[model samples]
Target: MCVVTAAREGQQAGCLVGFASQCSLRPPRFVVWLSKANRTYRVALGAPFLGVHLLRRDQHELARLFGGESGDDVDKFARTPWRPGPGGVPLLTDACAWLVGKVERRADWGDHVGFHLTPVEACADPLPRGPLLCLSDVAHLAPGHPG
Candidate 1:
């Protein structure tokens, strides 16, 4: 899972997204699926931008923080070093690579909703490119929001 962060109307939210993929290549589109029950989903609903972070294998702690705890109950940003991005979206300082994607569209799918993104601004740390954290890496994690 990768962490997705967004801010709208001065409220910020982040979460571990299990379903993300590059859906298009021409215009460079990506999709991050957020559970309707997840707090981030609520914040991202009308957000103009979304920050996508690719986590390194060693950053399992970050994965746990986003995937295992609910933002409604815990202040996830309080534990991470993040700053506001282009549209005031929160960007993680330690992400292997990060991108601020302008929300092109949002689709409602059963159980989870999709945020379609078109890359706007991005950065990648070239020095420490490592193995990416994947679904199997944290299969034991209890979701912050099961729905």
Candidate 2:
């Protein structure tokens, strides 16, 4: 699982994502699918960049915050430690690994939209704190928005 963040104008939004992966190796491309019903998706539609944060196995609370709480009624950033990244996107400080990517393209795929990305900046802990948080780790979380 990952948390994807975006900013457009002065508005920022983020959400937990279960559908994301590296789709290319040569040009180093990645793809993250955001539910059309999510507030983060709405903000991302106009954002030029995105911050993808890989969660640590121990960060269940963080996952719950992003995955189970709706941005429509909550300020996730005020509850977490983060900094403005490239293009003013929020970058989670507690991530085991993270990257800021330029939005290359977007495609409609049923209930979700796929954002194709090209990495612009990235960081990884030299000694990871734990294994990556996986889908099973967050399976109990109810989505912040309708699917």
Best by TM-score: 2
Model 1 regions more than 4 Å off? none
Candidate 1 per-residue lDDT, tens place, 1-147, comes to: 789998999788998887998899898999999889889989999899999999998898899999899989999999999888999999999898999999998998998889999999999998877789998999999888765
Candidate 2 lDDT, 95-125, residue by residue in tens: 9899999999999999999999999999988
Query: Cα miss at 4, model 1 (Å)?
Result: 0.6
Clashing pairs in 1: none
What TM-score does model 1 achieve against the real structure? Answer: 0.95
Output candidate 2 Cα RMSD.
0.7
**Residue 51 lDDT, candidate 1, scale 0-100:** 95
**Superposing every Cα of model 1 onto the true structure, what RMSD results?**
1.1
Q: Which residue pairs in candidate 2 collide?
A: none
Worst 10 residues of 2 by lDDT: 138-147
User: Considering every candidate listed, which one attains the maximal lDDT?
Assistant: 2
TM-scores of all models? 0.95, 0.98
